[model samples]
Target chain A: MKSHDSHPHYWKVFATFAKNSLIRDMTFRTNFILQCVSSVGWTLMNVGFYLILFQYTDTIGADTGWDRDKFFLFLATTWFINSIVQAFFMPNAEEFSELIRTGGLDFALLKPIDTQFLISFRKVDWSSLSNFAAGLVIAAISLWNLSARETNPMVPSIYEVALYIVFVFLGIVIMYSLMICLSATSVWLGRNQTLYNFWFYITNFSRYPMEMYNRGWGKPLYGFFTFVVPVLLVVNVPARILAKPIDPRTPSEWLLVGWAFVAACTSLLISRWVFYRALASYRSASS
Target chain B: MLTAPTWMNWKLSSWIMIFRTALEERLVYRGDFALGTLMRFLPIVTQIFLWFAIFDAIESKGENPKGLIGGFQFEEIVAYYLLTMLGRAFSSMPGLASGIAKQIREGEIKKYLIQPIDLIGFLLLNRIAHKFAYYVIATGPFALVFFLCRNFFINGMPDLLVISAFAISLLMGFLIGFFLEAAIGMIGFWFLEVSSLLFVYMLFSFFLSGHMFPLTLLPDQIEAVVNFLPFKYLAYFPAAIFLEKIPPEDLPLELAVEAAWLVFFIVVCRLAYGRGVKRYSGFGG
Candidate 1:
C-alpha cells in the first residue's frame, strides 16, 4: 500500500472505521447502557444547577437583556456543541498520548490512508451519540419554552441556522486540528497526561456563554484563545450565531468568520508540522 | 483474636507504611502533583470571582443586600463562597475505590491481602495522607487569598468556637465519605464494572452536598429535606460555621449527627468487607 497515494477513497476509509467502531461498541452492550444512564444523570444534575442559579438571579447577565430561558437555552446549546466535539474529536485526542506510549502510531504509519485522518477518526465511542442526542433534545425543549413565553417569538431564521451550522463545522475542523497538534506533542512528552487534563480544563470555557464573563477581561482573552488557539470558538461563536441573529452590516460577525477560517488553517498547518516533526522520534515498541 | 492494644499498634504501623508509600509515589509525579494543585485552585478562584462579579453588580444597583442574596451584603456572600471553597477542598477524597477495583481486577490486591497490614487501615491512611497535603497546599492558599481580598470580620469568640467545632465536623465528614468509598471498593469483588456506581456517588456528592451551590438557596422545603440527608454535613455545615450562620450553641448537636453518620458508615464498611471476602475468588490467581 502506497503511504502517500492521492487516489485513496477517503469515504471508504471512514465507512470501514465507522463499521468497526460500531461493532466494537455493540459488543459492550452493558457498558454502553450504563454510560448512557450516567450521561443522562449528569445532564439532569447540570440542568438542575442552572435552574437553581436562575431561581435566585433572573438572568445570567441582566444588563445584556438575557432572561432565564435565554440563559438556559445558551447553556443547552453549549452542551450540544460540546457533545458534538466529544463525539467526534475527544476520543481521538484522549487516545493520542497513550498511542505514542504503546507505539500504536506505527500501525497508522503503515496504513495506505492518511495517518492523521486514521488516528483521529479510528475509534468512535458510539455512546457519545446518546449525549449529543440528549443535548439537542434538551436544547429543543428549552427553545420551545422560550417561544411559548415570548409574544413575538424570536425563532432563528433559516439563514441564521445555516450560518451556525457552517460555523459549527468550521469549529469542529479547527478543534480536530488543535487536538492533532496537541496529540502530536505526545510523541515528544512520552506518556505525559498533563496535556490532556489541561485541554479538558480549558475546554470548560465553552460550557457557558462568553458574554456572562466580564467582556473587558473576557473579550481580549477570548479573542486570543478563540482566534489564536480556537477552543473558545467551538461553542461560543456557534451558540452566539444560533441564539441571536448577527447583523449583516456589523463588522464583528465578518471579523469572527474570518478569524475562524484563519484559526482552522493555522491549526491544520501547525498539526501537520508537529506530526512530521514527531514522526522522526517514532520508534516502534515491538522492536 | 488479637488484643485491642496489639491491633491498634498494628493498625498504626500499617498506616505509617501506607503514608510513606503514598509520599514516595507522589514524589515521582512532582510536576503533575503541582499542576493538579494549581488546577484544583482554579475552580475555586473562578467561582469566587463569578460570585464577586454578581454581588458587585447587585450592590451597585443600590440594594442594601445584607443577609444572603439580597438579605446579607455582598461581603457575606464572598465569605460564604470562600468557606465553601475551603470546605470542598478539605472534604474531597481521592477516588481510591476505583483504583482498588482496578487492582482487584489485575490481581494486585491479592499480594496486599497476604501482608500483615490491615487493608482498610492502609487505604484510609493513603486517603488521609494525600488529603492532608492537598488541604494544606490548596486550601491554605485559598484561605489566604480570600482573607487578603476582603475585609472579613468576626463578631465574637463564639463564632470562632463554632468554626472550630465545624472543623471537627468536617473531619468526621471525610471519614464517612472514605468508609462509604471503601465499602464500594469492596463491591468490586462481585462486580466487574463499578464506574457507573461511582459516577452516581460523585453526582450525589456534587449536588446534594451543597458543593456547587448553597443549601440555603434551595426552597425551604427542599432545604429541610436536604438537611436530613448526610450530604449537607459534608459541605454546608462547614460553610455555615465559617459564615457564622450556624449558632455557636448548636455546635454539639451537629457534631453528634456527624459522629452518628461516621459510626454508621464504619459498620456498613465492616459488613461489606465480610461478605465481599466470601465472594472474593482472587480471580487472576
Candidate 2:
C-alpha cells in the first residue's frame, strides 16, 4: 500500500546529492585525480615509515600482538574508517561554518527535510574514497601474508567475521557521530576555521593500536578515550576482532567490545541532542 | 617638509612599519592560533610513549641500556625528535605557497607591482613578523613541554658553540624555507591551480626533511641521496647540530652548504617573480 507520507523521501534526496556530487567532481576531473594520487602517496609514506620502524621491533608494542602484518591490517582498518569520514562527512563539516557565516544554514533550516541530514550529506569528496581503495589493497596483501605466515593458515570463523563487519560499521558511526557533534559547534562558534587541525589532534589517537596506550600515564588516557570519547574503539575494536581474538581471560577486553555497542547508541543520541540544541541556539544571520 | 632622508634610514623605518602592522594583524586574527600552537605539540606525548617502548624492547633483548639504532641511542633519539620539532617550528612555512598561489591566481600580485614595495621582501617581512608573533605566544607552552621532557636530554647541555650553530642554522633554515616555498608558488603564474603540485611538494618535503624519523635511520644509499637534497637543512640538520651529531670540523662545511642552498633558492624565487610579472596579466581584482 502506498502510504501518504508528509516527509520528503530521504533516499531520493540522497540519490540527488550523490548525482550532484559526481557532477561537481567531474567538473574538476584533473583535480579529483590529483587529490586521489596525493592521498595514496601519503598513505604509502605512512606504510614506509612503519616498515622502517619495524626493523627494530617485533611488534608495535613490546609483545602486544601487533606484529607487522596485523598492524598493517589495523592501519588498513584506520584508512577504511577515516576514508568514510573524509569522503562523506569532512567536506560538509568543513563547510558547516561557512554555511553559518553566509546564512546558508537559515535556508537549510527552512527546508522540509531534516537539517542534520541536509548538512551532513550536502557534498561528498569522492577523491577521499581512494584511501578506501588503498586500504582494501593493504588489507588484502596483509591478509595473504598473515595466512601464509601461519602454520595452519588461520581462517577467521564466521562469528568473528560477522562481528568484525558489524564492529567496523559501528566504528564508522561513532566517528560520524563525533564529527557531527564537532561540526554542530559551528552554529554557536560562528566561524570555526581551525576545526580541521583540532579534529586531526583528536582522531590521531585512533590511528594506532589501543594497547600502545596501556602503560604509565597512558593508562588514564586509555580509559578517558575508551570510555568517555570512545575514539579508541573507532579502529581498535573491529581491527582487533580480526587481528587478534579477545582472550577469555581478559574480561576488560571483552567488556570493551560489549561497551562499544552501547557507546555507538549513546553517541548517536548525544550527537542528535547536541545538533538540535545547537540549532535552537542558532540565531539566523539572514535578515 | 622635514628634510632629505638618508636612504638606509628611510628603508629601516619602512621595514619597521611593515613589521609592526603585520604583527598587529596576526594578533587581531589570532582566534585559535595561541591555543593551536600548544595543541600542535600534543603529538609529543605519542612520540614519548612510542620511543620508550621501542627502546625498552630493544634494550631488553641485549640487556644493554644504550643500544644504538641508526646512530641514535635511546635518549638521543628522544632528544632528536624534540629538536626536530623545534627546528620545524622555526622553518615550516604553512601557507606561504598556497597563499602565494592564491595571490597570483586572483591577480593580487598587481598590488605588489604597482606599489613601491618589493613582493618577496614584503613577504619576507610578513613571515618574520609571523614567526615573531608565534614565538611570543608559544614560548610559555614550549618552555613547559621542554621542561616536562627534560629526562629525554640525557646528554648534558651542549657547549656555547653548538647553541650558536643551532641558532645560525635555524635562521638560515627560515630563509631557505621561505624562498623554497615562494619558488614553488611562483609556478601559479603558469598554472591556475597549484594545489596538486603543492601537495606533492609537501609530501616529499615532510618525508625528506627528517620530520618523520632521523635521516640516519634511512639506509646508507637513501641517506646519501637525501643529504644531497636541501630539505634536510630545514629540519634534520638543525636538530642534528643541536644534538651535537656533526663533528666540529664538518660543522663549518655544513653551514656553508646550507648558506649555498639559501642563496640558490633566493635567486630562483627572484627570477621566477621577474618572469611571472613580465607575462602577468591582471585578472579580476
Candidate 3:
C-alpha cells in the first residue's frame, strides 16, 4: 500500500524484494548452484573463443584500436550490463503479456506503489546474476593485464573509474528503457512471443564495438544503430571510457561522449512515455 | 482412436499424414514464420562486417595471403557462413527439448503414452514437417541473402558429389540433433528440473558445434578434439563438405562417422524414452 514517491519507502520495499528473491533461490540449493556453475562455464567458453581468435588477428577489426585485453574488457562490460538487465528485467518483460492476458495486471494496478517499478522488479532471477560475478573477475584480469602491457597502457585514474561506473549504470538504464518499451507493446498485441527473440537479434549488434560498424556498407548500419535504435552507444561508450579512454585530441571523439549522455536521456524518456501510454489504453480483462 | 496399420505401406502412409498435418500447423502463421526467419538473419550483417575487418587486417600484411585465412578464402568464408545458415535451418531445435521437458513435468506427456504413435517417431516426423514448411516459406529470404553472398562462391557451383555429400550430412545432422535433444529431455523423468541441464548442454553444443565460428579456426589440437566429438556433424561438417574443404578421400569416412553418430543418438533416444516412459507418473491428473 506504500507509494514509491517517498524515497525511503521505495528502498524499503526493494530490500524486501531482494530478500525474498534470495530466500527463494536458497530453497532450491542444488538448482541454484548448478545454474551458477553453468553460467560461469559458458562465460569461460566465450573467453576461450576470443582467445583463439586473438591468435589469428591482433585486433577484432582492422585499425579499430580494440586489442585483445581491451576487447575482453568490453566483453566483460557487456556481460555485466546484460546480467543486470536479464536478472531483473528480462523475465518480467517475458511474462508481461501473460499478466495482461490473465488479468494479473489488475491486482498490480490496484497497489499504491508505482506500477512500472513493481512490474519490473517483482521477479528477480538470482541465478541469472551469476554471470555478473564472472564479469567482475574478467574485468579485473583484463585491467591488470592491460596495465602490465607496454603498448598504450590503460590504467584508469579514480575519477575515470567513477565515470566508468556512472556510464555503466547509464548503459543499464538505456537497456532497461529498450526492454520496457518492447514489453509495453505486449498490451496491444495481447501476446509477445517474439519479443525476446527480436531483442536478442537487435542486441547482437551491441556485442561488437561500434567502430566495427563504420566500414563502407557498415556506414548505414552504423548510422541506423547509433541514431535510430541507439543500442550502439549502450556498451561501447562505457567500455571505451574504462578500457581505452577517449583522448580530448579530437572534437569528434568528444561528440561521442555527448551523444552517449543524450542517448541515455532520450531512451529513458521515450520508454516512460510508452509505458504510461500503454497503461492508459489498457482495458482490464473480464473476470 | 484408430490403430496403426500393420502393413509397411500403410505405416509409411500414416507418417506422411503426420508430416502433412504438422506442416499445415506451421503454415497457419506463414507471415510470422517469414518475418521471424528474416529477423534472425540480422546477424549476417554483423558477421559480414566482422569478416571484412579480419580480411582487411590480413590484407594489411605485406603478403597477398591468396584470399585465404584459416584454410578458407575470403569469399569461401562467406560461402561457408551461407551454407551454415542452411545447415542450422535443419539442425537447430530452438525449444524442442524444453518443450518436451515441460510436457513431461505437466503430465501432458501422458497423451503420447495413450496415443498409438511412438512418441519419438511422432516428434521426429512433426519436426521434419516443420522444417519442410520453414524451408518452403523461407526460401525467398534465404535466396535474397544468398544472392547478396553470390560473389562468395568463387569456384561457382560445386560438383554433384559435393552437393550430395552436403545434403546427406544435413539430413543426418537433423536426425542427430533431434535425437540428442529428445534424449536430454528424457532426463526429466528423473530430475523434475532439466532447464539448467538443458542450458548447459545448449551452451556447450553451440560452441562445439561450430555455430559461432568454424572449428577449424581453433588450434590444431583443439580442432582434432572437436572432430572426434559428434557436434561438428550438426553444422560444420555439412558446410565443410559443400566447400570441398574435406579432401576427396576423407569425404566417405566423414559421412560414415556422421551416420554412426546419428545411429548412436537414435539408440540413446530410444533407450532413454523407453525407460522414462515406464517411470512417468501422471502428476497433474
Ranking by DockQ: 3, 2, 1
Per-prediction DockQ scores? 0.45, 0.66, 0.66
Candidate 3, residues B111-174, lDDT tens digits: the string is 8888767888888889988888999999998998888878888888889988888889999989
Candidate 3 local lDDT, A1-287, one digit each (tens) = 35556543777778898889889999999989998899899898989988987787777766667778888999999999999998989888877767887878899888888888888887788998989999999999999998898877768889778988988898899899999999899889988777778899889999888987897888998999898888888898888888763343257655877888899999999998998898898888976
Comparison by DockQ, 1 against 2, better one: 2
Cα lDDT, all candidates = 0.70, 0.86, 0.85
- Tell me the TM-score of model 1: 0.88
Off by over 4 Å in 3: A1-8, A245-249, B1-13, B99-116, B277-285
Q: All candidates' TM-scores? A: 0.88, 0.95, 0.93
Q: Please list the residue runs of candidate 2 whose C-alpha ends up more than 4 Å from where it truly belongs after superposition.
A: A1-4, A150-153, A245-249, B1-5, B63-65, B283-285
Pick out the ten consecutive residues of candidate 2 chain B with the lowest summed lDDT.
Answer: B1-10
TM-score of structure candidate 3: 0.93
| Highest TM-score model number | 2
